[model samples]
Target chain A: MHDYTMPFGPQHPSLKEPINLALELDGNYITGVKMRFGYVHRGVEKIFEGKDVQKVLYVAERVCGICSYAHSSACTRAMEGILGLEAPTRVKLLRTIVAELERLHSHILWAGFGLHEIGFQSMFMLFWRERERVLDILEAITGGRVHHNYNKLGSVRYDLPKGCEELMRKNIAELEENLPGLIKEFEKNSVVLARFKKVGKISRKDAITYGLVGPMARGSGVKSDIRKIDPYEAYDDIRFNEILEEGGDAYARAKVRLTELGESISIIKQCMSLLPPKPAEKWKWPPIKTGEGFGRVEAPRGEDFHYYEIEDNIVTRGKIRTPTLANIMILEKMLIGAEIGDTPVIVASFDPCIGCMERTMVIDKGKKNWFTESEFRRKFCD
Target chain B: MKRSPWISHYNASSCNGCDLEILACLTPRYDVERLGIVLRESPRHADILLVSGVVNMQNKDRLKRVYGQMAKDKYVIAIGACGISGGPFHEGWNMAGPVDKVIPVDMYVPGCPPRPESIINAIAKLLEGLE
Candidate 1:
């Protein structure tokens, strides 16, 4: 080891979010990785407290941008558990469809990001271009493309909007037509394979030890898909297979996600077939009673868990364990003993959401807002 | 289109909504590069600074340092409601304030996350005002 250390970012090209990592290098090879969080911390759990029960639903969705629907799903399910409300089958089906669509867009976004890191700009652009179809489908249903505020306590805010079902079917068919070719191109690409295969290989044992979830663990042939293991929101009613890869490397994880995209498409189809014309349950929310509830939903990254305590129609306490928190544990191990050239590829493989994980940070008290924009300009901008 | 405004993006504490939209504008469908606008990597090379999310204690100073790194002609655009006024997370215990609190903002593009079209419109407006 040369024992030289270099800082990767709090702001850098390869990283979409702000995260600083100190890397110990031996020439072009990285020997150690020390990750520092807290850049995107907003104290969401603290923010959830004392908020109205129905209102906290939106806050939970805001927890992770990629997994917004999953967080809202988890949050709603938990509050439903506390309220003892069993939403009708139709509601479950709608949620499942939206959730699967979210996975579609999210996986595509990840693919674009992964391709971008490997410098395959055309493929990156292609992936994102395809992603817009899924986003358009989502916008047709929820009225908002990215931040869909669709979920409510007892029922969704609205029934599947008129004509949205047709829109969904058309988009799904188009994506079904396009995905195989894209995945085939991705797998066959020499640059992608060379950069990804056997890079950051993890054993099933290490994945288990590190408690890796989502595609990270699934890549190692671990069948830990919460949708299959502990089905929620019509997941049990749907027919789909859990995609797994035995390779236990970056390519394997990416393969698992790409393969799962097909499976998610199937699940959404099943949900559409199962969705009834009538509203499943009314949108009536009862008075919030004092109780504790927990929910688990398989976010795109992994299993996202939410716990909430209600008192007199307001949240008294709340905690969220996002998938990124679990998946990021294996990142430091993956980076060790690897060439520094592969740093971005290896890090992007984890799809780390520091915003979700950094929700837990040491709050700095007495840090109050100071000065307006003009005041700051007068003092600082030169 | 005088000098091709090169843009840099920073996330203070976003949920990724606006950030994703900003990147979406660069894709084939929106393809802002065709208009000669490039998304640069370094703040030093950027002419326009796109800041997303609410400012918090951990990132407040980093935001300042990043703003300082950009050249004097930098145009700062606060993206999304969070960037403008902290949005739904204004009550966050760790939130320092909006983007404008710590740095001067030349434009405020509002939405929980403004669409890719909104971002494109912001860039056009920026160019028009620049001329």
Candidate 2:
């Protein structure tokens, strides 16, 4: 068969976000993959420069909706680190609760997408149905569902509303009750197992070499979860297991996320009980004089890091490194030898946030004499 | 409406807030399908182009292309704050403008990321306007 190039995206159904994948196909197998990003670049990093430390938090949260709370927390923590500001124990616990909730919702959302990619519509519905309860918990705590804007400079935006703990406890119980059955079905389903079991396999060494983070690394048995390694917020005070799998395939990645969902629930429950007496709102942010610091959080997809340099309350330089940016490069390796049919499944397995990953790209066609637009119009529009 | 409206979603330089909410709109809680709204993958078959996010330089042309591909008498619902007025990233060097500047938007659903119910209301209003 002749080698042919198939452009997969920019706007394709298989992709939940915009990403252009130039796939070199030899019959059913993909021989090469060229990725073009920046289809969704809103100039987030550029926008961060010269913004007030207070307002930058909102912009940070908007970096990616799935991990909005995490990004916001990371931004706040970065500012706090620079100013030597430490939030009270209760504020730390509250931040942890919201962050874990963000993790649960993001993981469940990805699971649903995974099921959808594999042609399991009913399973997708089931996953999302359970996810709504998680969203309810989020809505109860933070005002908005997706853009929670819950993180402030030194403390979170809101305290747990009345009965919020009981509500969370009840929701956690319901999720714990339902997740096992979902996992059992996912594991037993032959079609799901067939499509994902050994597909897009990555070795532990390769995962490290590719700089994979979050579940993508944990799936390959690399104990690289930043939460456990470098505990932040209330992570040091809380106890939770770092979920891992040794299979290093798409199935393993899914398993890691599913298991981590339970871990997130448990962490939230622990955080709720450990809440300190002082209200979170009482903690205030100190005036930013001049300093630089880095903050990192274990976001749903993986490690999310933010580094900033502030001079007189304005962020002179700010850098955010989201997990998808760390994990997306590995797709080039994973998709090289996979079948065309498995492209979407393998890509979805990474749970890539292309919106966060897109930087900038200019499509340069060079000096080649291609057919002009007028030539095409003259040929076809006559 | 004579037939179910098939909708196609386009994310033109969004932060994914509006995009995820659009996904949630289809899930069990919202179950937009009950409104005779089908989510189609291809732009050609879609009756309503559900656009989320601001129009950036790179995606502006792509968004316009997708809009042009839709059938005649189609409607465009610009969802989210970014879609309506470019929101926080309005001053970015890469952004061209909001959705309406590039394409003819019929209805606007405004939120940082509008709720699923809000999206449904926008759809209902669009249908009402169509009548």
Candidate 3:
């Protein structure tokens, strides 16, 4: 078979987002992979400059559609860190509740997308149907289905409203009843087994060395879940086991997310139980001053880290490192020897949110760069 | 028979909010298929272009190429704040939209990410206008 090169995406049906992949193929097996991004760059970090903390919160939510709340929470925490203030116990619990719900929504959406990639259209539709239930609860709470804009510096935008508890409990019960059966069926399905098992295998050492976070790392049995390793918000108070799998393959990663759905459900239930009588939590804005802080949250995809330097309540310098950016580089190595047919599944397996990860790419020049908050300040603001 | 409007979607630097809602519109709950609306992967086969996100320099030409390849009677419906306007990222350095600057848009659905129902409504309205 002659060696042939094929370009996939930047625009393709398999990819939900635009990312161009250059594949060098010898017959069906991939000999090399080159990735090109910047198709979805919205200039988020650049937008952050000169924006006040409160305004940056809204912009942060726009960072990633799937993990909007995670970015906002990270942004809030970073601002709060700068102010040397902490949200009250109730506020932290509220944030955790939304955070877990976001995780559930994101994972289910991913499952549906994964199923679609593998030609399991019915299951893909089923996963999305399940996703709507989660979205209903989120909409009920945040009043926005997709972009919650729920986070604030010292408190969330809205408190848990009356009758919200019953709604949560009802959905929790439904998800609990349905998710297990869905996952069980998925596991037993021969097609899923054939497609997922041993494909795109990542060893434990590579998972660590590559600095993988979220389910990608956990699937390889790396203890890199930020919620477990370094608890933030109400995570320390919430009792849930960190999900792990040693399969180190696509199946393992999928299992990690599927199992974590149960963990997220339990965590939401716990947050409800811990809900305070008067959950309307808020704090006064402090006097304008200058400081810098770092915030890290375990987003559905993985660790979402944000750094900010606030000067007079406006962020003069900001940096965001979403999990996809950290997890994406490893794709080059993983794709080198895989079957061409397995490419979409492998890419989908990574859950590449190109929009979220495109903050620092310039396709015209083929340059990729990330800046620390301090370095960013010195280079741009100073 | 009024054929289902085959549509192609392009994400132009969007956060995926509107894009997800578009996906939802096709799923079982919204089931735009019942309305005879099909999502096509190729622009040539599509009668309408469903565009989401803010336009940026990098994706601007690509979005145009996508729009250009569509059928002559192609209808462009810009979804969400980023579609009609850049929304939050409007002032961002890389922004090249509010999509109309890149291509003529027939309709605009408003939301940070519009709900799936709203997206269905927009399509229905578009169909009505077409008649």
Which is the winner by TM-score between candidate 1 and candidate 3?
3
- Candidate 3 is scored at a TM of 0.95
Give all TM-scores, in the order shown: 0.95, 0.95, 0.95
lDDT of 2 by residue, A305-367 (tens): 999989988988788888999998888988998999999999999999988787544434456
Root-mean-square deviation of every model:
5.3, 5.6, 2.7
Against the reference, the lDDT scores of all candidates come to 0.88, 0.87, 0.89
lDDT score for candidate 1 against the true structure: 0.88
**Best-to-worst DockQ order:** 3, 2, 1
lDDT score, candidate 2, position B10: 96
lDDT of 3 at B103: 93
Model 3 docking grade: medium
The clash count for each model shown is 0, 0, 0
Interface root-mean-square deviation of model 1 in angstroms is 5.2
> Which wins on DockQ, candidate 1 or candidate 3?
3
Task: Go through the candidates in order and give each one's DockQ.
Answer: 0.54, 0.58, 0.73
